[model samples]
Target chain A: MRTIKLTLNGTSVSREIEDNRLLVEFLREDMKLTGTKESCGVGVCGACTVLLDGTPISACLALAVHADGRAVTTIEGIADGDRLHPLQESFLRHGGFQCGICTPGQILAAKALLDANPHPTRAEIQHWMMGNLCRCTGYYKIIESIAAAAGAE
Target chain B: MVPFTYLEPASLDEALALLAEHGEDAKLIAGGTGLVNLMKQRLVRPDFVIGLRAIRALAGISEKDGLRIGALATIQSLEVSELVRRHAPLLAEACGHVATVRVRSMATLGGAMAHGDPNLDTPPALIAMDGQIVARTRRGERTIPVDRFFTGYFGTVLERDEIVTELLIPKQPAGSGTAFLKFLPATQDDYATVSVATRIALGADGTIREARVALGAAAMVPVRARMVEAALSGKASDEKTLGDAAPLVVDAIDPIADFRGSAEYKREMAVVHVRRALVEAAAKAKEAR
Candidate 1:
């Protein structure tokens, strides 16, 4: 076991994790940041996506130990105490999700995209979200939400 | 995916030392995009994972001696860099077509190179530029040509305890041009069907002075289409020369059957991609000149 020091959301959080602990487990279980979802416990599906050092990475694939001292932001981190992220607002307005299973990942992926590319073209938006699969097949709606958010930006 | 002791070494030296101690029982974790997926499928069962995240030196991109790409330079970084686009447009263009934006942000150059997936888009493109991979270990440091990086499918010449530290892509001549084309499998995203990277330099007389053709996903290692190059030499390359060169490349390669493509289909696509890449790259070279 190793004690890791890192920042989560807007807080400085530290903990000791098992040598084999995956970041997805630490986030969803230990930290109780259940907002971040996990479908494929592999990197293929971006359901476990989180911004690690400002990049959307799969929490399931990242070893908890590897995240030591790194800044991690889960879906739970996006909004302020009582506010919603702009992308979240656009998602709600557009009904960006169907079953909501891929919502957290979709939102987080969009947030990362908009963070790097404040105004992305429609093709760029589709190209960026290619890794995160939506089994719900609400891709057009999701793409619309992200595009609408970009237009607003 | 299984339980394993994870170590995040703060320095390259520390990481190499840990790897030296653990040897084959240990695996190096970079972005963990591909490695973790394979591990989850029980394809990789290492007892230890040496995470390279903390090694600051392995994580950024900058120019030195032509172009020095840090081992951990993310695909997103390459795709987003104006320097990469200017210095090596083929690299930027090829990386831009990687899985997706989020994946590109998480996937590192060295990790992808070290992962040694035959279908990977960047390696063949990089190899076409005659790139060199620099690796370091507790034992010592060694350099491997990008063309010789892979030994087999999902396998590399990387020895235990060694970590790739840098990639050196020679900056092209002022007027040279390059292009890459990839055929994604219709069934899955995990593999590549046929991919080609071609670079051509035109002479003052406007014929092919130099040519490099690299093909991936059609062989165990990225194949350099020597016969295609020979066929293209000093020719008035129009669509015809490119068309003729493609089949020469097709004959030169020995593709294998995989879930992504049948050997026959792969060989055919290899021809198609080579034709397209050659035509595109040759035109670009002529325009640049």
Candidate 2:
């Protein structure tokens, strides 16, 4: 086991975790932040996407110990207490999800894209969100959500 | 994943000490995007995982006589690095297409090369650019040419006690152009069915002065199509010549039948992509002149 200290959801979190524990497990089981889902643990599906130091990374493949002294922002951290983030509101407004299992990852990945390129073109949005697969929505609404959020932000 | 002792060394000396102590029992993990997945599948079970993430010296992009890409530099950094874009755009383009944004943010260039996966996108690009892998151990430092790095499937010349520290890619010569072409029949993020990377240096006379052609997913390792290169050198970069030279790649590659395609189909596609890559690179070389 190893002890790691990290800023999670804008709060510093220090915890003891097994060396093999994945960041997804640390966020869901240990920190009780089940907002991040691990549908495809192999990093192909971006269902476990989270912001590490403001960059999108696969939490499933990352070891919790590797998150030491870093900042992690999950789906749970995006809203401002009773108020939804622009991305969350945009996603909801645009009906960006049907199954909703892939919504968190889609929003997080979109957030990273907009953070890096605020005014990305539709092509850029498609290119960036290619990894976050949403079988139900057909990805049109997700793209609209990101584009809308980009304008609002 | 199987339980293992995690050791994060603060310095290169400490990491080398741990490797020297554990030897074959230790696995050096950078980014952990590749090694961890293998561990999860029970494909690789190491008693000790030496995390290289803490070694801050192993992450940066610098250029002198050539480009020095730190071993821990993420693929996403390479994709956006202006230095890499100016020096080696082929690498940047290849890195941009690897897996996805999230995976690229966590996958390191050195880790990708050390992983020695034939389906990977960077190996052919690096091999075509004549890159070198720098490895270090308590014994000393050694440089292995990227062309000679991979030994077999999921294998390299690296010893258990040695760790890859950086990748040194020399600047391209004048009048040289490079192209990396990947044939992804499925999703955008899927591994290429057959990928080709070509570097063509044109002479003042408009003939191919020198050529390097490498293919990914062609064999157990990234195949340097030397026969194709030899056939094109000193020849005019024209349609007939390329058509003749393209078929020679089949002689150099031994592809396996997988879900991507049959071995026979891949060999045929290799010829097509090699031809296209060489043609595109030749055009760029002409433009550079």
Candidate 3:
């Protein structure tokens, strides 16, 4: 076990976790922030996407200890008290999801993209969001949602 | 993942000491993008995982005499670094094509090189550009030429106590051009079926003075095609010369039949891509002239 002190969402968190505890598990179980899902246990599926120091990374592949002293932002932290983030609103407005297992990851990944490149082209959005797979919506709605959010922002 | 003891060392000296004491039973993790996956799959189960994230010394990208990229420097940093883009654009381009933006954010150059995965994009580019990997142990430091670094699939010459410190990429000489071409028939994030990296240096008369060729996913390791290099050297930098040298890589490569491509198909693609990479590099050399 190790004591990891990190900033999650907005709060500073310090916890003792097993050495092998994955970041996804730490967020879901320890912190009870279940918005970040883990579909592909490996890094490919991007369902475990979270921002580490403002850059997106696979929570499943990253150990909890690796997040020590780092800032992590997940879907749970995307909205204000009553308002949704621009991407979240856009996702809903654009009907960007169906069955919604991949929504949290998709929105968080898009958040990272927009944060870095404010007005990315459709191609840029596609390229950046390629890792975040959406099996239900067939991708067009998600792409449109991200593009809409870019314009709205 | 199986339970293990995670050790974080605040300094390089401490990390080295920990490695020296427990490296045999431990696995040094930088980004954890590679090693963590292996551990989760039960492919690798080490009792101790030495976390190098806290060691501030092992991170950054700078251009001094040449490109000195710290081992812990993320691949995303290299892709966006102006120093890397200006000096070794081939490397920058190769780094950009690695898995995904998220993976690049966490995967370190040292981890990729030390992972010794032949299917990776950076090795061929690094080999073509004459990059050397800097490794350190309690004994001291030593530089391993990128071409000779990989011993086999997922293998390197690095000792148990040794950890890769940084990668040194020599600046390209004047009148030289480099190109890294990855043939990804599947998806952009998928590994290349047969990728090629070529460097062509033009002589005063526009003849090839020196040429280097390396391929990824072509063999157990990144295969450096010396035969193709030899054939292209002293020859006219033209399509005919590229065509003649192209077949030489088939003899050099030992591709396996995988979902990406059949062995015979990859062999053929290797020739095509190698020729195209050489031609593109030669054109750049002429343009530089």
Candidate 4:
């Protein structure tokens, strides 16, 4: 076991976790931050996408110890108090999700994209969000949502 | 994943000492995009997991006579680095096409090399550019040419105590043009059915002065198309010259049949892609000249 101190969702937190604990397991199981989902445990599916130092990474592929002294942003941290983040609002406004399983990852991944390029083109959005799979096949809506969010900003 | 003790070494010396002490019992973890998955599948169960992220020395991209890419540098960093794009545009192009933005953000070039996965896009690009893998151990440092670095599937010539420190990629010759083509019949992010990277340098007279060709996901290891390169040497960069030489790649590759393609299908695709890559690179070389 090792003690890792990191800033999670803008709040400083310290925890003693198993060395083998993955970032996804640490968030969902230990910290109760279930907003991050793990699908296709391999890095291909971006269901467990989270922002590490403002960059999107597969939480399932990252160990909690790797988060030490780093900043991690998850879907639970996307909202401003009770008000949903613009991306979240845009997703709902544009019917961006169907089953909602991949919604958190999609939003977080989109958040990282918009943070890097505020005004991404349709092609840019597709390229960035291509890794975050939506089995519900609501991709057109997701694209629209991200575009709308970019425009809203 | 099975339980294992995690060790974080803040310096290269400390990391090397840890490796030398643990020997084969310890596994190095950088970014974890490749190693974590293998551990989850129970393919690699190291008693000690050494985290290399804390070592500040093994990060960043710098240019001297050639590019010095630190092992801890993320693939995303290389994809966006102006120096990388300006000096080795083919490498930047290949890095951009690795998995996705997220994987690129976490996968390091050194980690990718150490992982020794033949299906990866960067190795062929590295091979084409004459990149070298710089490894360090308690004994000393040695440079292994990228083409000869990988011994077999998911294997490298690295010893138990050796750690890849950086990738040294020599700048391409003047009037040289390169192309990286990944044949992805499936999803855009999927590994290539057959990937080819070619570098062609032209003389002032527009004759091919030098040529380098390499392929990934086409063989057990990334194959350097020496025959194709030999065939193109001193020849005019024309369609027929490239066409005749493209088929010579079959002698170097032994692809495995998988869901992406049959071995026969990949061989055929390899020839086709090699021709296309060569043609594109030749055009670029002419423009460069």
Off by over 4 Å in 3: none
Q: Put down candidate 2 lDDT per residue, B1-289, tens digits, no spaces.
A: 8889999999999999999999989898998888999999999999999999989878899998879999999999999999999999989988988989988999999999889999899999999999999999899999999999999999999998899999999988889988999999889989999999999999999999999999999999998999999988899988789788999999889999999899999999999999999989998999999
- For every candidate, what share of the true interface contacts is present? 0.65, 0.88, 0.80, 0.92
Clashes of 1: 0
What is model 4's DockQ versus the real complex? 0.90
Q: How well is candidate 1 docked (DockQ)?
A: 0.59
> Which pairs of residues collide in model 3?
none
For each model, chain A TM-score? 0.96, 0.97, 0.98, 0.98
- Candidate 4: which stretches are off by over 4 Å? none
> Candidate 2: which stretches are off by over 4 Å?
none
Model 1 root mean square deviation, Cα atoms: 2.0
TM-score for chain B in model 4: 0.99
Every candidate's DockQ is: 0.59, 0.90, 0.84, 0.90
Question: Residues A33-102, candidate 1, lDDT per residue (tens digit)?
Answer: 8988889776777888888888888888777876777899988888877898889899999988888878
Ten contiguous residues with the weakest lDDT in model 3 chain B? B53-62
Which 10 consecutive residues of model 1 chain B have the lowest summed lDDT? B183-192
What lDDT tens digits, residue by residue, belong to model 3 across residues B1-289? 8778988889989989999999779999988888988998899989999988888778888888889999998888998899999999899989988998889999999999988899999999999999999999999999999999999999999999999999999978789988889999988788999899999999999999999999999999998999999988799999998888899998889999999989999999999999899989999999999
What's the best-to-worst order under DockQ?
4, 2, 3, 1
What TM-score would every model get versus the actual structure? 0.94, 0.99, 0.98, 0.99
- Between candidates 1 and 3, the one scoring higher on lDDT is 3
Instruction: Compute the lDDT of residue A144 as modeled in candidate 4.
Output: 98
Cα lDDT of all candidates, in order?
A: 0.84, 0.92, 0.92, 0.94
